[model samples]
Target chain A: MLQTEQEFIRILRSRLEGTLPEEELNDIVSDYAEHFRIGKADGRSEEELFCSLGSPDDVAREIRATHLVKKAEDVKSCKNIFHAMLATLGLGLFNLVFVLIPFILLVVLLLVVFLFGIVFAIAGPAAFIYSVLQILGIPAFAIWQSPVAGVFFSIGITTFGLLLVIGDYYLARFFYRIGIRYLKWNISVITGTEDEA
Target chain B: MNIQFKKGVLEICVLSVLARKDCYGYELVGEISKRIDISEGTIYPLLHRLKDVGYVTTYLQESAGGPSRKYYRLTEAGRKEEHEQKEEWMRFAASVNALLEGKNDAAD
Candidate 1:
């Protein structure tokens, strides 16, 4: 394959066009353009410079990952962080084990907690209504041995469920912050090792 | 050198070099690649990340015979980071070296 400056820039631009803003994309492209320009002036062939620069696809991947991660940090959102995680995962197969597995586990864990909270919250209210009906002499809703105790228990359950939901929210947020830091560190430390190719 | 180890230290290397003096993108890549064996392309992304984190700033400076080049200089935060990372790396390296030497002596 031809390792020309044009080819390199094209690959980079294609990879990053939709992900990065135009001005920022242009800025990144210009950096490499300048590098190639300067290197050519130094009497190095385009091939040698391109080879030293390594693969353009790899470069673009790293840039994409970094930019997405930064964007995620700036705008805290599930979508942004998920995009960042996907980008980082593209860096290498190593991330499948290191990033993807943990990410899936965390998501599943959060989802389960959220679902449990929802179930308990909804069930608590329904049970409370049933207990009230039982107290009002509705035999059809007479599941409770003690109507008054059922009322208190249902209220307690509702409060506990609400607390669990709220706690889960904060837990998700805490994990989000920690996850961002870990992704940043992971990108810095784990990336670029594949450049040996 | 282990590639993973090299990748981990690349950020510190860039910071340490920029700490010495401002350098253009190509110049900075040259400075690091001159010693370390890694992709020169990765440095640009690292530089961008540093800039994003408020650790470095860039400016256009005219070169001798060509168009102006983008030069990167460490920000105040960058200098502090460089100092802290350098210290940490030194201590960590020293401990690792000591442990390796002790293990070698025991083996002998």
Candidate 2:
């Protein structure tokens, strides 16, 4: 309810406390403190300055999103990018369609590919073992028409599976890179204070 | 102007301002808000982002009747970015203007 500098700083500190590093958080707070100080000295009331600055909550959210995205870029990891995506999603409802849906779809797609690769990889070795057993006079293991051909087929399947797994990895990496760029652009162009005229 | 459109250009505007001369946080916000209606708080975060990317750097400068203020100066990389963005914006604006004018003539 208060539009004082202290209230603005309080909201920012509370919102950003755990997300930003201590030094960086202090630096940001000082920027605002200085802003209020200078504006007041210019004979403007604290409420006028505060209203012009918009909501501190939005400011904190933007800063947190930007920081997380930059961190993801600096340290390449699934967890980092996931956190970055989550942060960006908080920017606006636009992200629910633009960011959240694509993110979920990508994750599901990648998971399905990985699971298929693993199943094929495991099945190839099992089939190879069964074919060898059938050749060694085990009647029940006779699934393939030709044992020699089965061996070749099993090896081919294994190679294909392995390739799929490796391809999925590179695909994930590529999307991770593109996703970071998109999130950066989204933050820069999409989010703004509600006080837009 | 669209809010999203305004936000998209905020970076270029800030870079262009810093390209001209170093400014303290309040001074820079004043310069931009005078021309564009925006949440003045957002500029600080933009400044921080610029600093993070090494596009700008800051130093403390004492004022006549106040404590030291942090002044932001554009880095070499920041200057290059400003020039590129300015050129891109110019071309984009020119084409849009041409299209609008052509449409106006056809309407008449």
Candidate 3:
């Protein structure tokens, strides 16, 4: 294949076209175009300039990762963070262990806590209903203790469940904040195009 | 040099160059590639990242024979970052040099 400025810019544009905003994409493309223009003016051949610039695809991937990570930081959401993580994973295979594993672990942990909270919350209401029925002498189910005692236990379970749910929300928010910082650090340090050197 | 070592130093290299004087993308790439054997394409993305973080800003300057060029200048935060990184790199390099010389003497 011919190593010309057009091909370099084409590859970069094709990869980054949709990922980056239109103006930002144009700005980045202009930088490379200018680089080629100046290099040629300095008496360097197109092929020499292209070869020194390295793979345009790698450069595009790094740019995309940086942009996605920044977007995630600016707007915190599941979709944004997921997109950011996927982009970062494309940087290298090392992220499978470093980024992917930890990400999955955190998601699983959050899910477990959320599910447990819901189960307890529902169970507390059912228990409360059963205790009320027992108090009315309906004899729906055998009581472990007095119906009054049962009411207290049920309330305790409800409160504990509510606390778990609230705590899980705060925990998710905390991780999201820390995760954004980590992603930014990863992009700036671990995932740069220079890493491919 | 190890790839990881080179990757870690690229930021400092870019910052130090801009700390000296603002440079257009091509000129900056030439300056760095003259010393470090790395892809020239990487520097542009690095510059963008620096700009996004407000460490560097760009301005258009007219050239003698061609269209205006976009030159990257370091921000105040960028200057502080450069100074801190330079100091850290110097101390680390000094210690490593000392350790290597000590090992050479012991080997002799």
Candidate 4:
């Protein structure tokens, strides 16, 4: 209600997210027109309302914070898209290298050490318990019947699982790094940042 | 806010907000001011970007007491984007946390 209906529509379309329907824009325009009419003389321009209302960019920022994807979509195609994609992917990579990778490796190492340590330290006892359980006939599943086969299989499963997890974790990190680097390269290529070089 | 950082992340935040409800220009100013210390003028540019992408839909409504007001709402794509961005943020943040204190300090 700060300017004429037409002026309000233009401002809303330009100042707010542009995706609003035309009819809705008309309504906004009328509201502002009425508000401006009540506030001042007919000779005054809608710019006054714009100024008093505050920076349109500021409003966009607030709106964007809430509706980032919509706002991002309308941005000039070649201009911001690369950057936006770079943003998420870059940050994700940052997390992977500085945070995720080392942490995962550490966990893997600990797990391996713990599992092997148990084998060396308390494993004898654990194996004794396994045979005892078989004698007690806990279940077909529990009674491996073959001590060597069961022990080897248990070791194999634990080691294989640990290796597999560690391998997958490292692979992910490598792929993420490559992906982000590729994306950054694409952004630079499209934006012509190399010219600055 | 760092201009670079703000420019990158702010767009995501705005779209996410519109995904929830339709808001007017001034109402947006009031809401955003509550959280981050941003120049009120910057929001205008952000809105422009959203329009370009076609993620948000806007319409004007008549006010009983005042002039018509422009109200912004999210399109289908806009809603999906909000969820995606949020998911990414949470996962990224969690991954970051895992790196810091979650590391095996005892491994060495």
Per candidate, native contacts kept equal 0.76, 0.84, 0.76, 0.12
**Runs in model 4 lying further than 4 Å from the true structure:** A1-197, B99-108
Which is the winner by lDDT between candidate 2 and candidate 3?
2
Off by over 4 Å in 2: A192-195, B103-108
Candidate 2 chain A least-lDDT 10 residues: A188-197
Worst 10 residues of 4 chain A by lDDT: A188-197
| For model 1 chain B, the run of ten residues with the poorest summed lDDT | B99-108
Q: What's the true lDDT of residue A95 in model 2?
A: 91
Candidate 1's residue-wise lDDT over A1-197, tens digit each? 89999999999999999999999999999999999999999999999999999999989999999889889989999999999999999988899999999999999999888888888898898999999988888885677799999999899888888888998999999999999998998888776445473
Q: What are the per-model C-alpha RMSD values against the true structure? A: 2.4, 2.3, 2.9, 16.9
Candidate 3 residue-wise lDDT, A1-197, digit = tens: 88999999999999998889999999999999999999999999999999999898888988998899889889989999999999988887788887999999999999999888888888888899999999999987865668888898899888888889999999999998898888777766664443455
Which candidate comes out best when scored by lDDT?
2
lDDT of 1 by residue, B1-108 (tens): 766788889999999999999999999999999999898998899999999889999999888989999999999999999999999999989778878777555334
Q: Report how far residue B61 has shifted in candidate 4, in Å.
A: 0.9
Q: Is candidate 2 or candidate 4 better by lDDT?
A: 2
Segments in model 3 whose C-alpha atoms lie over 4 Å from true places: A191-197, B98-108
Candidates ranked, most accurate by TM-score first: 2, 1, 3, 4
Q: Which ten residues in a row have the lowest lDDT in candidate 3 chain A?
A: A188-197
What's model 2's lDDT at B49? 90
Error of 1 at A36 (Å): 0.7
Cα lDDT, model 1, residue B62:
87
